[model samples]
Target: MEPTGSERGPARYEPGEGCVTTVVRVPVRIVVLVLVVPVRLVWDVLTAAGRVVNRTALRPLGRGLAWLWQTLIVRPLVWLWHTLVVAPLRWLWRTLVVAPAAWLWRWVLVPAGRGFGAAVVWLVRYLVVVPAQWLRTYVLAPLGRGLAWLARGLGAVLGALVRWIVVVPAVALWRWVLAPAGRALAAVVTVLVRETGAALGHCWRAAGIISRALGRCLAAVLRWTLVEPVRWVYRTVLTPVGHVIRDGLWRPVRQALRTARETVRQTRREIRRALFGAPREPEPARAVVPRREPGGSGTRTLGKTSGRDVPPPARG
Candidate 1:
């Protein structure tokens, strides 16, 4: 039968039945998944392990970058501290040593310089100045004063000697000349007086002798010639004729006698008038001095002539 299609199909196991022989043949897709899943798991695990290995390989490079950053930023701060702070401490050490050395020189050395200057000044005064002053005062001044005193004394002595020697001799010579002249004048006066007295005495003696001789001669001549002749003539001739002549010529003779008397009287009067100026009128005649005899000295002696008295001669 090909059977009826349904029933005749292979023995016909019933739906429930047949040895239940289900020949479950899973599908091809399930089969393929089950096979491919383990392979996929293994691939994923291997890729994860490869990524971790790559990260580990880059770690050294990152560490090198961090170290370079720290070096650039921090090294300048440390170098600045050493320069500003540490160098100043070294300079301070040198300054401290030099300051102490300069102070020692100022305190110890200045006084020694002043002492040296004072010693030089003392040595110059003792060596030069003191000896010069002593020589001027003690030796030179005393010698000059002594020479001046000697010159003054010598001038005074010379002046006194000149006055005594010259003046005394001149006074003695004047007295010697005047005394001889006075004696000569006195002798001349005495001679002149003696000569005058001798001349007067000679004249008086000669005049007296001549007057006496003249008087005696005149008397003798008159008596002899005139008186004798007149007496003889009168006696002889004139006596007789006297009477006759007297009578005749008596008148004429008498007249003549009268005339003669008159003439004589007139002549006497004229003579008196001539000698003593005019005569006075006639009165009684006064007596004159009496005359001495002719032989005696006439009238009066020469000594008695008072109106002719001689005066004495004048003396020098």
Candidate 2:
């Protein structure tokens, strides 16, 4: 057993070593001295040999090879491609395709487009739009006016004929013959209408009375049948049961959901702590812990100063 931080000051272990040096540190030092030193020497030797080879032979050889490849192979290929492939193709394309296209665009296509477009516009205005406007103004407009005038004259003649032929005879017949007959018929119709009106008034009164009774009955039926049943169900069944379920079931469900949410939140916090390391707890001010020397001798340090902000010492 060891004396922990609160129980006692720091102490040394057997074999004249502290607890860390005896248990954890000695093997580490031995492994480093025994294994790491030779490996480091071998690595240094190999790297030195490599550096010497590079400086003496390999560097110049690689630089010469690269220069030779670039100057002989790469530069010639690039020059050949530029001279034989690129320049000839560019010249041929300029002479065969681009120059012809430019000439056609400059001389033929552009002039055709402009000239034809303007000619088509003028032809359209002259042959179609202007002719249509001229026909409408000169031929169709006068023809339409003449047709309207002839139509108005014909209508006036027809209206005068109708007035003389139909309306004059009809007025004469009505004034001489139909007026007396219509008066006699209207007198008889007046008497019959009075009698029919009296009868219809009685029928209307009876219908009004019956309709009032039926309307009252319909209102009563609706109230007793639909309204009372709905009211009873709402008041007795729905509201009471709704209250019971809300308080008994829904309230507990909400509380359980709230508790589960809080539990999940706490679990997430714990998981985050485990994954990302512990939360940075507020620290107290630092103090140094030094080893106790034997036989009242001056104190000696086996490791670095112990403080909150002291960086870790170098490794083995």
Candidate 3:
């Protein structure tokens, strides 16, 4: 067996590899190599040429195009926008719109708005605010007070009626009738609950006792009727019959079957050999050679090292 890990080489044989693989690999490799060399050379040459063209011609042309666009197109467009559109728009706004608006606001609208606002203030004070204040003081205040006094009187009467008619009767009924009835009901429920629990517990225990007795009877019946009879039949009758069958009948039958099987197999093997000849023995595997190290033999010892200054010691 060979060592594995890094010592193993990649040239190991696959189990599926056969004469077909051996025959195909050399021709395929040779054809592929022949076809690939020219394609690879052309690809390399094209790649180098593309790099040179991009570096020498395309880069400079792109830079020139960008500069021309900025200088001739972008700068002129910006200049024309400022000169033709922005400057004229600025002047027109100051002359036609801004000046006229400013003058209208300062000269006409401000004074008119001031006078109108003063008139509006005077009219509102006399028409809306004064009337509202007078109404609140004279009419609404007295009416609200009269309605409040009436409501207070009605509330006092209603409160007395509710106390006598509803609250007192309800309180008396709860204290005298409902409270005692509730207490009696609670007591009845408590007695019923305790009795129910006790009855259930007694029933469960009696049932358990009956169940245990019944289980014992059933187990005894089964043991006598089924288990013991089955045991006796197996031991006295079936056991002997099985032994006799095995010794006198089954063993011989099995031996004959085994012999017949072996004979059939032998006959088949002989037929195969007669038709196809005996199978060839596999060739022994060749020994694997260990790989040689690149650095040759490593770490030479002092005993093996030779000295140039000293004469050789003669062997006796």
Candidate 4:
């Protein structure tokens, strides 16, 4: 159909004016189906990936990081901080607290030590050394000197007393006793000499008297005994014989003497005659001279004729 001009002009369905148009209407359910389903599927995939990362890789990484921080990083950092910072704080506290206390004690205690040492030295000097020195000076030295003086004085007094009392008396007594003995000896010797001289004088006189008496008595006894007896015998026996001899022999001798005298005269006459040649003449007889014996006064005649005058010799 080839339709002619103007009518054909616009194969249009006109509702009101001269324009040709087509109007299409969409469904709500179809829109929802396309957009909502794609968005939900993408969100689910993303969520599952996040869970795997956390479980397989991210969780282990987080634990290793925590261990490293505690052991290597965090603990070393804490030790370094204490060494560098906290140690100085503790030293400061000690210096502040203890140093002041020690200084105060030294300042207060030194004076007390010095005071105690000085007190000990003073006590030793006063109690021991001073007292010993005082005793030596005041007590011991004076006592020694006093004792020595007393001993010397006593010795001198004793010596003087012994010499005066004992020695003098002994010497005087000896002299007195010897004087008496000497006087007595002189008296005894004088008495003995007088007695001996008297006795010798008496003995000599007695001897002389006894010798004279003995001589007189001896002579008297000899005359009475031996001499008297011999005289008596001679008187008794020889007196008569002597008288006879004297008478007989003398008568003859007297005759012969007369004859001889006559003859001698005759012979003288003959001799004278012969010589003269003449007869001799006889001469006359001459007178004889008589002898005398000596007497007290003068010579006395001794003859028979004088017998009467002589008083006849005493018979003996």
What's model 4's overall lDDT? 0.67
Clashing pairs in 3: none
TM-score of each: 0.19, 0.29, 0.33, 0.27
Error of 2 at 61 (Å): 98
Ranking by lDDT: 3, 2, 4, 1
| Cα lDDT of model 2 by residue, 69-157, tens digit | 99999999999999999999999999999989999999999989998999999999889998899889989999999999999999999
Best by TM-score: 3
The models' CA-based lDDT, in order, is: 0.58, 0.75, 0.78, 0.67
lDDT of 1: 0.58
What's the true lDDT of residue 50 in model 1? Answer: 64
Candidate that beats the other on lDDT, 2 or 3, i.e. the better one: 3
- What shift in Å separates residue 214 of candidate 3 from its native position after superposition? 4.9
Model 4: runs farther than 4 Å from truth? 1-175, 225-242, 267-316
TM-score preference between candidates 2 and 4, better one: 2
| Residue-level lDDT tens digits of model 1 in 197-314 | 3323332232323333444566666656776666666777677679778788998889999999999999998998898889567898888978557445333564564333546667
Instruction: Name the runs in model 3 displaced over 4 angstroms.
Output: 1-144, 201-224, 252-316
Question: Model 1: residues >4 Å from true position, as ranges?
Answer: 1-185, 223-244, 247-316
Model 4 residue 314 CA deviation (Å) reads 83
Report per-prediction Cα RMSD to one decimal: 99.9, 47.2, 39.4, 99.9
